[model samples]
Target: MSVWDDLIGQEPLAHTLREAVAAARDRLSGGSGRGMTSAWLVTGPPGSGRSNAARAFAAALQCRDGGCGQCHDCHTALLGTHPNVTLVATDRLSIGVDSVRELVRSAALMPANGRWQVVVVEDADRLTEDSADALLKSLEEPSPRTVWMLCAPTAEDVLVTVRSRCRLLVLRTPSPPAITRMLVDRDGVPEVVAAFAARASQGHIGRARRLAHDEATRNRRREILRIPTSLIELGACMVAAANLHEVAQEEGQGVAATLDAKEVGDLEAIYGASARDGRARGYPGALSTLKKDQSKRRTRVVRDTIDGALIDLLSFYRDVLALQTGARTALVNDEVRADIDSLARRGSADSTLRRMEAVLKCREAIAANAAPLLALESMMLDLRV
Candidate 1:
C-alpha cells in the first residue's frame, strides 16, 4: 500500500524508524525539546533492503504527516526530487574524496524546504579511507538541522569512529514465507513459482525478485543445481565450471554495461560541451579518469555476479549433503527436489560433504585474492573422484 510497506519483513526496523519519526515530529512541535539525532547507520546483508529503509526514513522525516503517501513531501522524497533530501548512490567501486567533499559541502547548507536536511549514503562500505575521514569530520559537528543516514553491510564496514557516533539499525533477512507472500501479493506470481524462488534465494530479496521475474535466471539456477548429478567425468566437471564462469560474467556484464555507457556518455558530454575552439587541453586527463572508474566498476560488477553464482552453487551442494544425511530440514534447492534426490542416491554423505568443502575453499581463494578462474578450476577438479 504505502512506501513503508514495501520494505518487506523488517518489522523491528520499521518500528524503530517509526519511533524516530515520532521523535522528530514531537521535537518540531515543541520547539526542539529533545532535538533530532544527527546520524543513523543502517546495516544488513546484501539484498536486505538497507538502502530502501533509509529512503523510507527520509520520506518519513520529510512528510508533515510522517510519511503520508499522498503528501507532497513524501512524494518528492520517494521520487528523489525533494529539495532537502540528498541520496548518494553509485555503481562505481568506491566513493572517492571528491564526491564525499561535495556531500560535506551540501551538509553545511540549511534545508531549503525548512524540514530536515537529510543526506542518505547508500553504499557506505565503498567509501575510501579519505572519504570516511571527511565524512567523520562532518559528522563530528553536524548542523543542528541536518540528518545523515548511512547504509552498509555491517558496522565493521565503516570506521569505528564513524560507527560509534551514529544510531545503529540492524535489519534481518526476510523469511521464506514472507518473501513468498510478497511475491504473490505484489508481483502476481504463481504460487509454485513464488515458493520456489523464495526457497532458492535464501532470504535475498533481489535474487528472489530476479528468480520470479526472469525466466533465464531461474533456468540458469536450475541448470547449476543439476551439476552434481551430471558430473560423471573429469571433463564434465571442467565444462561445468567453465559454463558457470561464463554465465556469471555474462550476467554481470549485462548489469553493468548500460550504466557504464551512460556514465561515460555523460562525462564526455560535460567535457565536449566545454571543449570549444580546440582549447580542451585537460580532456585527456578527464578521459583517463573516466576509463579508470569504468574499469573499477566492471571489476565490482563481476565480483557481485560471481558472488551470486557462488551462492547458487553452494546451495546445491548443501542440499545434496542435507539429503544424503537425512537432515529432515528443508533444502535450499527445494524446487529441484528430484535432482537433489538423484544426487543423494548417487553419492555417499561424506563425499557430498567433501564437495561442499571444496566449494567453500573456492570461495575462500577468491576472497584471498586468488584468480577466480584458477581457483574455480582447482575446486572443480577436487570435486572429481
Candidate 2:
C-alpha cells in the first residue's frame, strides 16, 4: 500500500503533499517548481495524523518515484532509517536545547542518498523556548538541500517566529464514519466493535484501534465510565477517586516497566555496574542521573494516563449533557447509551455541564502537579448525583 493509505479521510491534504513531492522531483531534475518549501509546519488536533503526514512527506521526498511506497527509499524513510532523513521525537516532557542543536547540525548536511535531507520533528510544541531559538536560526538560514517538517496540535502551539518561516498544512479530525471504515477496512476489526471504538475515540485513530483490539483498554474505559454512576455519596466519591488513581498508576507502571528495565540495563552496561563488576569508578553520579530521569518519565507517564482517563470521563459527561439538551449529534459513548440516558434523567443539563467542568478542572490540576488523588477526589465529589 502507499504511504498515504493509512492517513484516513485526508485526501485533500494528501493530494497537496503529493503535488509538492512531484514538484520537488521536477526541481531536482533541473525543472522549475513552485509548490515546494524548505520548511513546513503541519498542524492538527491530537490523533489527527500530523506525524503520519510528516513521515509520509519525508518518505515521498526520498522516494525516486515520488513515494511509490514499495521502493527502498520510501520504506527506509517511513521507518526512520533513511540515510538522509532525521526524525526527532521525544517521550520526555520537553525537547531541550541540546537536542535542537543536534537537529540543527543534522539539517546543515546535504542529502546522502536522496534529493532532500529531510528532518521531521514529531513534537514541535514540546520544544523549550531555548530550543525553539536554536531551531529558528536553522529555519532562517536553511540549507538548499534540507527540508524540515514540524508537527504540532496547532499553529498557536508553536512560536510565531517558527510558524512564520514555514508553510502551513492543517489536517481535520476524521469523522466517526471515516474512522469506523478505517478500523474495519484497514485493521480488520469487527463492524460492531469498530463502530463502538470509532464513536468512543472521538476521531483519534490510534485510540479507536486500541479500543477495538485491546480488551484491557476497553475494560479500563468501562471502569472509568462506571465512576460517574458510582459517585452516589461522599464516601463513594472518595472510593471512586482512589480507584481511578490506582487504575492510572497501574496503567502507567505497565507502560513504564519494560522501558525502565531496558534503560536501567543500558545504564548498567555503560557504567560496568553489573552483578559481577559491581560499580565502576564514577558510576554513582551517572546512576543517580539515570534514576532521576527515569523518575521524571514515570511521573509523566502517570499524568498522561490520568489525562486519558479524564478525557474518557469528560466524554461520558458530555454524552449525558447531549442527551439532556436533546442534541442531534451522535453520542461519543453510544455503546453506553442506556447508562447515559439513566444518568441524564438523574441530572439537569446544568449539572451535567458542571460535571464536565469539574473534569476539566481536575485535568488542569493534575497538569499543574497537584496530587492526582486529591484532584480526582474533588472532581468525583463534584460529579456525584
Best by lDDT: 2
lDDT of 2 by residue, 111-195 (tens): 7774899999999988888999999978877987889999999999998989999899999998989999998888899999999
Predictions in order: lDDT: 0.83, 0.88
Model 2's number of clashes is 0
What lDDT tens digits, residue by residue, belong to model 1 across residues 3-121? 58878999988888888788888876765535357799999998888888988889999888888777888888887788899999887877999999999999879888777899999
Please identify model 1 stretches exceeding 4 Å from their true place. 31-35, 273-281, 346-350
lDDT, residue 239, model 1: 90
